[model samples]
Target: MFIDRLDAGTKLAQALKDHPLVQKIALADRLVLSIPRGGVVIGKKISIQLNSRHDVILVKKLGAPFQSELAIGAIAETGQPFIDQSLVNQIRVDDSYLREEINRVRAKIAMYKTKFRQDKELNLAAHLTILVDDGMATGETMKAAIAWLQGQEKTHSKTYHLSPTTYLIVVPVAASNAATDIRALGVELVCLEESSDLTAIGQFYERFDQVTDEEVIKLLAKN
Candidate 1:
């Protein structure tokens, strides 16, 4: 268990220090892309420890109709959406609902990019790209970021040379199922703990509090 997000970030940053990829990639070539607002705390620690660039990766969960807490999937800032077909099929979700949710979630992502990043674009030309989150339960948001990065690699391979040697996901804890799904994406993962019967990410931290947009803005500014 962690005392708070700061403690989790410290531990995760230490773990990254011993990672094989960290040994191969130079500090200047490492880019830490954190998912706000809690993940920004983690990302700050990582960037400081690794002496790398830090930035926010905007992605929002697509909540199910009448169930805002339940995520059907997620959409990233690049407008790439990852829908959980199995969940949608089980819930009998229709295409129209998904289309609407996509538009709404994508709009929120754009707003975050403007507010948190001031409409600044990310530099994807790094040797190692690290994605950090406080913890992962369903892992949809992180997957959305990965999907968008993969798309960039394909689309800008020759034009911009945007392919990184490695893409790593770091989190203090992750649900076992979500870990498996994330590994299937072919990215390296550094998880301090994997819970088979995971409930909520807050359960692992004693001082888990909601992070505000203002706090996120400050953290990004520090980077």
Candidate 2:
């Protein structure tokens, strides 16, 4: 009932505000990161209200060949990314196909970096990182993001001389199963609504228009 009954982003924000886990962590004092296209609007609002650093954590999904809407895997902000191994195995995607998709996603990330390099100077060392997306269905993108964060911690530990920071994943709405799966990753999760009513993320949103890359770039510039 919480799903499809209110403004997706606002409701999600409020839910996070009320959650005991969120209260314990005090997200208002942390660095809030979000993936573009979906996370930009939500992240901006949260940043303004909470007085936290809102930055984009670029993640692009690798769509199925010919059926581009079907996500097979996802790439995170860092160069490291992941795919649903079971899905990849079930689909019988060859190494060439996987490489091609990976390269495509990397190219997209490169373009994003080129456009927003100036905005990447925020100090993530010892700062709490909150990752946001609009919603979740398969949890592939969230998994990729978590994996990427681990890699970043490993690679930057020496240079930054900081221990791995805590991460929290927030979303407006998510499949009950998907939320559970994400929580099992041993990270804090803040999901506002969990329902079987979810078919697609857009279905619950009253204003589910596409967020362009240009808009994301502009948002980053402002922050």
Candidate 3:
């Protein structure tokens, strides 16, 4: 039982089963868009259980100055990722600095897109999009992913005549306030653990290994 609990993949699957949003969206029809790296493992398990389309959404965070683990912004599949402007301004990050970081992220996105996003444009119109991540501390990455999805809805409306889009955010653990902020975006949010006492995401899990780009690519290749 201890080895069973220590398995991140198994724990992730069980957590998703208990998640309210997962119960609602992991039905017969839906697509799961998991955040790259850690989320890929969770997404794979969910895909097996739900028998639905599963794909990865590459979202990279722009680290805060002097505190690299602290994210001030994040880049999703789209061109411009979401940035907590107020936080950036409060931290005294000038526009030039932000631009430099954003451009760097865009380059990374381009590389990922070439490697992974070569499929037909995701027709999220009238489809359920479930966004997943391994964990959440600040929620900057999830926020950016949501904003990017919204942008896709708008841009695709002009070219492809499709209906509105629906999205959901699913994570294993998240800060209470960060979960609240994500819920305010008017989309369904699922978190197995929401603790106000939380400080770091890795603290909640026993094995929090760093996932590399090559590993992520290999995982997604199975989809």
The sequence of per-residue lDDT tens digits that candidate 3 reaches over residues 40-136 is: 8777776766666787777889888788788899987766768888899889988887888889988987787777666445545335677888888
TM-scores, all candidates, are 0.94, 0.84, 0.84
Name every residue pair that clashes in candidate 3: none
- Quote the positional error of residue 53 for candidate 2 in Å: 0.6
Candidate 2: stretches off by over 4 Å: 1-7, 18-29, 119-122, 158-165
> Taking the tens digit of each residue's C-alpha lDDT, what string does model 2 give over 121-219?
435553567788888887788878777777777877764322333677888878887888888888878776688757788776666778877877777
Q: Cα deviation of 18 in candidate 2 (Å)?
A: 4.2
Report the backbone clash tally of model 2.
0
Off by over 4 Å in 3: 1-12, 15-28, 118-126, 158-165
Q: How do the candidates rank by lDDT, highest first?
A: 1, 3, 2
lDDT of 1 by residue, 64-111 (tens): 888876778999878788898899999988999999999998888889
If both were scored by TM-score, which would come out higher, candidate 1 or candidate 3?
A: 1
Local distance difference test, each candidate = 0.87, 0.72, 0.73
- Candidate 3 residue-wise lDDT at 186: 82
Q: Would you give me the overall lDDT of model 2?
A: 0.72
